[model samples]
Target: MRSVPEWAQQRGFGIRVEWGRAGAVAIGAGAAGVVVIDVLSFTTSVSVATAAGTAVFPYRWRDGTARSFAAERGAALAVGRREVSVAQPWSLSPAAIRRAPFTERLVLPSPNGSAIAASVEGTPVVAACLRNYSAVADWLLQQGWGTPARPIAIVAAGEQWPGTETVRPALEDWLGAGALAAALLDRGIDTPSPEAYSAASTFTALPDTPGLLRTSASGRELISGGFPDDVDLAVDLDADNTVPVLENGAFTDHGR
Candidate 1:
């Protein structure tokens, strides 16, 4: 399990990392702010779609409910698969959303992405990957997400399936979370854990890597499945820093 106290102290924001299903629920229930990391593609696409001001209705079904719903409303859909490459510097524009009706939804079917979206039902949801780390940090600071009472929690969408070995924690997600914690600490917060510092320090040590896709489990899986280019796409930092907000059944760009 990721360390929550270290993040809380380091960022001066109340940040925690939960390891199990119950922890996911606790964070989602507004116990703290949540950041779900599914680096493979699902969360990334949701972030892009939401940042573009589109409503993202993430369904767990493989039968095409999300696609059909989006088609019914005329929304452009981005289909997600474990083997597809994550598009670089991707963005969904507000104009595109305007072209589609309410029935249209972006159907993102991934092992981790959709699950994270579904977890955070009523809290402020933002997509975090190596690509938008700094942008996300700056945006979070601007929004006071690291304030004392408002804690930030990162949810890593580990491999969830029958017969799959336990998904080891990815280095990038921890580092990304650490960087976020460090940024928060820079704003006069109180993060004191060595682990948090270590994670943030690791990210700073290697600033050249664009995003987490190159060094994450999800990214590796996609590559093995045939999308090697996606690793680079998901790691570009600050390429687009639009903060995605979940409302009703979709995500909207909350950036100014």
Candidate 2:
């Protein structure tokens, strides 16, 4: 019953995966749904917020715009990880935000994940991290989204240095994407793209994910920045079953 154009677009893809902004636009164009995985924090934060029954608004990390953006939405802007405190209600740290007093809505800004998420045009976008990869995969399967005829694009929202346009793929996100890809494979979805297969293979080959994540570059950076707890929280694979899906400009728990 679907229109020709819509069906054509869905049939054009078969489990493609890519990194950062380019993937947000290019791969999102044809895929049935796009999954944005930013394990260092953004997607992880979204998973935590949605798990707590809150909606999260994605915003690009601009110094002055975030406040006004949140104000316009009648939501609070989440602070940086280091800015989180006992009195601070929200922050980029997933562990911290998970414990904060629950708010109905929040605007979370990031240079990578949030930016790519906010920029995605028409495709349904889902946030994924190690904590909720299996949950997301199960949700996708329930939605019948990972079929061979209607593939998904799993995007790793890699980190970008300030004042630069280029982004470097983070190992954490690569593994996060791989984890989701592997989950889909377990459900009988075949990956046509070698990139997706490689990512899944990389994740499956890891024997001690949590131990390894502690030594990742992003993990070390977070630890050095006073968020050692966040790295530990990020590697808690399948810790949650909430799938945060972006809808009407904010991420809310799927099927809610």
Each model's lDDT comes to: 0.54, 0.85
Candidate 1, superposed: residue stretches over 4 Å from native: 1-13, 19-21, 27-32, 50-53, 67-77, 80-105, 165-167, 192-198, 206-218
RMSD of each: 6.2, 4.3
Q: List the lowest-lDDT window of 10 residues for candidate 2.
A: 1-10
Q: Per-residue CA lDDT of candidate 2, range 1-256, in tens?
A: 1233443232344777888887666566657889999998999999989998999999988478898998899997898876777666698888888779998989999989999899888889999999999889889888788755667888899887667878988899999999999998898887447788899999999999888888988888898888888898899999888899999999999843
Residue 130 CA displacement from its true place in model 2, Å: 0.4
For candidate 2, the per-residue lDDT at 40 reads 88
What TM-score would every model get versus the actual structure?
0.70, 0.91
